[model samples]
Target: MDEIKFICECCGKEHESWPAITYNSPSSYSNLSDQEKEEIAVIDSDFCVIKHSDQVDRFIRCVLIQKVNDHCEDLEYGFWVSLSEQSFENYLENFDNENHETQYFGWLSNYIPQYQFTNSIPTTVVTKNGNERPEIFPHQDFDHPFVKDYYNGITKEEAEKRIKKILKN
Candidate 1:
C-alpha cells in the first residue's frame, strides 16, 4: 500500500504515514441499554469522563502501548478525540446528508492526560455522514489552567515519567 503523507494541521508536522480508522456502524453503542447509555453519556469533551477511575488507568496503559507502537511518529500532541455514543448518533442523523460544508459537534470518548492536550484542538475525520467526507469537530473547554498547560508542550521525559507513575500506582 502506498503511504499517505500530509502536513497535519493540528501539530504542524508532516505525517509520513498513519492509519486512520473510523467506526460507522454503531453496533456496539446501539447494543447498550438506556441505563448503560446514561451511565456513559459523556457531558464534557474537554476532559476525560472516566478520569481518576480504574477505567482511565487501563485506557492510559493501552494508549501508551499504541503511542509507542502505532503512532510513534510526530503525533499531534499524542492523542486523538473520538465521538461519544449520543454525539455520534446525532452527527450521523444530521450531517450525513446532502449538505457537506457545515461543521458538526461531537463529544470526546478518548482522552490522554500524558498527551498534555485538551479538546480545543480540532481535526477532520471521515465519517459515514455522506460520502462527501463531512468533518467532525471535538469541542473541548480549556477554561481550566491545567488543560491549557497540557497543550503547551511536554518533554518526552516528562511524558515517560507520567506514564511510569500511572503504571506504578
Candidate 2:
C-alpha cells in the first residue's frame, strides 16, 4: 500500500490524494460480501471484486470508473467488475458503436502483452509530448447538399460569418 500522488507536470499543481483504490484488490468488487453488494446496489454503483468463496475459479472482477476515457480531472469513484482475459479481449473486439471504447481498445493493443488484472487504471493528461486527443464528437454530418459543395472550399470569411451568426443567436 504505497502512497499515490498525482502531480500536474505542466502546471506543477498537486492534486488531492484520494483513497487508494485499485481495480485489483481484496476490497475491490466481486470479492465484496452480500452486504456490500446490497449497499452498492442500493446506491446504483458498479465495482470490481471476486467472490472469496470462488477465488479458486481463476477470475478477476472490476468496477471500472465511468470517466475512464475522459479527462482525469473529472474522474470520481466508480463501480467495479471481475473479468477474464478472454472476456476482456472479446469486449475489445466486439464493442458496438461507442467510439470511446474503440479508441481505448486501439490504445490498449500496443500494451496487450503487459496487461494485468491487478494493475491500477491509467489516467490521461495533456502533456508536452502531445498524445492525440480522443474524438470528442460524432463525425460531422454531411447530409446537406451544401456540405458537398462547401467541403473542401470553406473560406475563412464564410467560417467567420457562420460563427458570428451562431454567436449572435
Candidate 3:
C-alpha cells in the first residue's frame, strides 16, 4: 500500500495511511439534500440508511479489488451497495457476529469516476468471517465498461491516474 493520507471531515483528524482508495458514503446517500439527510438518512463507516417516499434504502460499505495488470499492487475501492430489505435485515442481524458468513445480491451504489456510467452494476456481496466489511464482485454478464475493467484489469499508469483523480493530490 502507498502512503495516501487525508483529514477526516468529521473530526478534522489526520489519518496516517489509507491502503485502499475509499468512498465515504454511497452515491444515493450523498445525493440527498441536507434537509432530506437530516430527516431521513444516516451513515457511518460501515452502513447507511435512507427513508424517503415511504420506501427504505439500505447500503453497506464494501471493498472491491481491481487488478492492476502491470503493477505489483492492486487497486482497491471502499465502495457501497444497496441491499434488498431481507438481505439488509440479514446483514444487520449478523453485524456483530465474527463467525457469520454469507452472500447477497446487491446493486453497486457508488460512482467510480475513471469509468463513465459506473454505478448500479449487478453484484454479489460476500461477507467474510472475523467481522470484516463485506466485499463485492460485479456480475460477469453486466455489459458495461466498468464491469469489463473489473475483470480485465488496468495498467499501472492508469491506476495511478485514477488515484490522483480521486485524491486530487
- List per-prediction Cα lDDT, in the order shown: 0.38, 0.30, 0.87
| Number of clashing pairs per prediction, in order | 2, 26, 0
- By summed lDDT, the worst window of 10 consecutive residues in model 2 runs over 105-114
**Superior candidate under lDDT, 1 versus 3:** 3
Highest TM-score model number: 3
CA deviation > 4 Å runs, candidate 1 = 1-15, 20-90, 94-98, 113-141, 144-169
- Give each model a TM-score: 0.30, 0.22, 0.87
The 10-residue segment with the lowest total lDDT in model 3: 10-19
Instruction: Give candidates' CA RMSD values in order.
Output: 11.2, 17.4, 7.2
Error of 3 at 158 (Å): 0.9
Extract clashing residue pairs from model 3.
Answer: none
Q: Write the per-residue lDDT of candidate 1 for residues 1-169, one digit (tens) a residue.
A: 2457888676688865533322222222334467754676333222223322343211100011123222334222223344545544555465536654443333333434444434444333434334444333232253543344434534544444554554454
**Better-scoring candidate (lDDT), 1 or 2:** 1
Q: How accurate is candidate 2 locally (lDDT)?
A: 0.30
lDDT of 3 by residue, 87-168 (tens): 9999999999999999999999998886677347999999999999999999999999989989999898888788777887
Write down the lDDT that model 1 would get.
0.38
Candidate 2 has a TM-score of: 0.22
TM-score of predicted structure 1: 0.30
Candidate 2 C-alpha lDDT tens digits along 28-112:
4334577866654221222122334535211222222222222233222221322444543444344332442322211110011
